[model samples]
Target: MKTSTPVGTQADQLQVTEDGKPLDAVRGTRAGDLDLRRTVLWWKGFEEQVVSRQQELHGIGEDVVLAAQAADTALQESPPRLAGEVFSAVAEGFSTVPGEVPRLLVPWFAELARSIGREVSTRSLADAAGAGVTAVQRAGAPPAGTPSLLDALVPAAEALVGAEAAGVPAVAALHAAYRAAADGTRRTVEDGTVDPGALLVAWFFERGTVV
Candidate 1:
């Protein structure tokens, strides 16, 4: 993975090789001393001396594929984004570039926008649901999933489990009546389970059915 030094011009090539020999990789070998700098005069001399230097050293002496690979390497070595950095970068890219593009890149931008929004939206929903649950608990309302009478209604949910259960008036109205009665009474009955898990399930599900 030894790359030619970073000389971005043609003349630099000949000067680097003016003695008419290839590089001696061993001469500069030193641990933790990679990406070393060459003398300015060396670079200047290379710039003045080379004939096909830029092309010769184009992307570290590699061809087009090598050039692309070098670019990819550079990109890999580049810093990674912080939490907001990527979004900001992509958003800026999206804002600035508003036209047809390389086919490979379109889905990238589209997916970024979609995932970002979806993540944000899902995060918001989770926060809201959490807050809603907390609020209900604080208000001493039964949790949202089932009604307070859920153990009383497990027989109900199972009895009227499927859509066909919807046709059973007794089963259907059973949930309806339970909900109706529960909705009317938030008073924690002295002997009753204040807010059963089943209660939340029943209220949310049955309420949805009725609506």
Candidate 2:
């Protein structure tokens, strides 16, 4: 992956290109990188917003961080069970409540989707789920389908948000999660058994269940 600093953009801003052409595999790679950068910028700006609206952001921030911590802990302590539970929850939940969505989380998830691929939308539960999974994949998840990917991604995400919640630098935390997820995925795949949970989860998500 060759990189170049584009003219007229921020001096440090890189336009990640494939050779001389724009990267487009797995959803317009260059554009996705740019968009992800934009999301990072937005999060940076959100710090200022948080200062201005402490009451609103505090709870949300805590919750996000805590979720990451929980997921991380679960993955480390019980990778198999965690894989099963997460898979079952998403799969079963989607089947019953295909349109289920987190309260007031549309914008946040939308940003996540955009950071991975330029055109994914959060309006549909299936799309939203795909975007979340894809973002995890792009962050360094294995090439496997949903179950294995989630096994890697869930914990890394927990660390990502947990670091931010602890006031760690946002970009650093994100990059860390990416590396961690990729490494974990590689190890899990080497174990040679797809946790049943991961399989079920992948099955449901691919089945087009909502939520």
Candidate 3:
């Protein structure tokens, strides 16, 4: 379905004020708190391993891509299901991890398929999560083991499915998954099993530019 409104324009309109401050202002403050060097390193690795080779990494089906595009179009044209404040938060959260919007469509499509009573395999979800772990390693992060990363990514995929089932906007559902994944990354970092630099790489896949 064609959208009369451009996606960027629609996204811009959704950026409303929260507590008398624009959401972007809030995001900017949050962004300032992050480690710039680590963030840049992570983005570089992700851009090379994941964003630059999304199709090769994820192996997403054409049908899923089409479905995700259609859903995004619908969101662009229709009024948002979430309140402005909530929508802005979701948008900001998703935007934190660049290039995640498209990769996330894989799980989003899975949810839509299941909603229509189509049987979706759990293996498909596992593959998606595993791909992310592989991307992190390829991005120059030390080997943190697949199981630890999967422990975080698997639930993140589930969060996307759950958010979709709750009738949230596609963008918001993607953000939900990102938040879950970010939480996992945070825990992994805290455990000291993974480097802080690795958090940046994981954030990109869990959520980068080429070096």
Highest-lDDT candidate: 3
In the order shown, the candidates' Cα RMSDs to the true structure are: 31.9, 19.3, 17.0
* Per-residue alpha-carbon lDDT of candidate 3 for residues 115-211, written as tens digits (9 for 90 to 100): 3221112233333444544554454333333324444455566675576457554334445555666555544432223322323323443321111
Higher-scoring candidate on TM-score, 1 or 3:
3
Which candidate do you rate higher for TM-score, 2 or 3? 3
The count of residue-pair clashes in candidate 2 stands at 3
lDDT of each: 0.29, 0.33, 0.36
TM-score for each prediction? 0.19, 0.28, 0.31
121-173 per-residue lDDT for model 2 (tens digits) = 22222233345655545544445444354664455555555554565433344
Candidate numbers sorted by lDDT from highest down: 3, 2, 1
Our tally of clashes for model 3 stands at 2
TM-score of 1: 0.19
Q: Which candidate tops TM-score?
A: 3
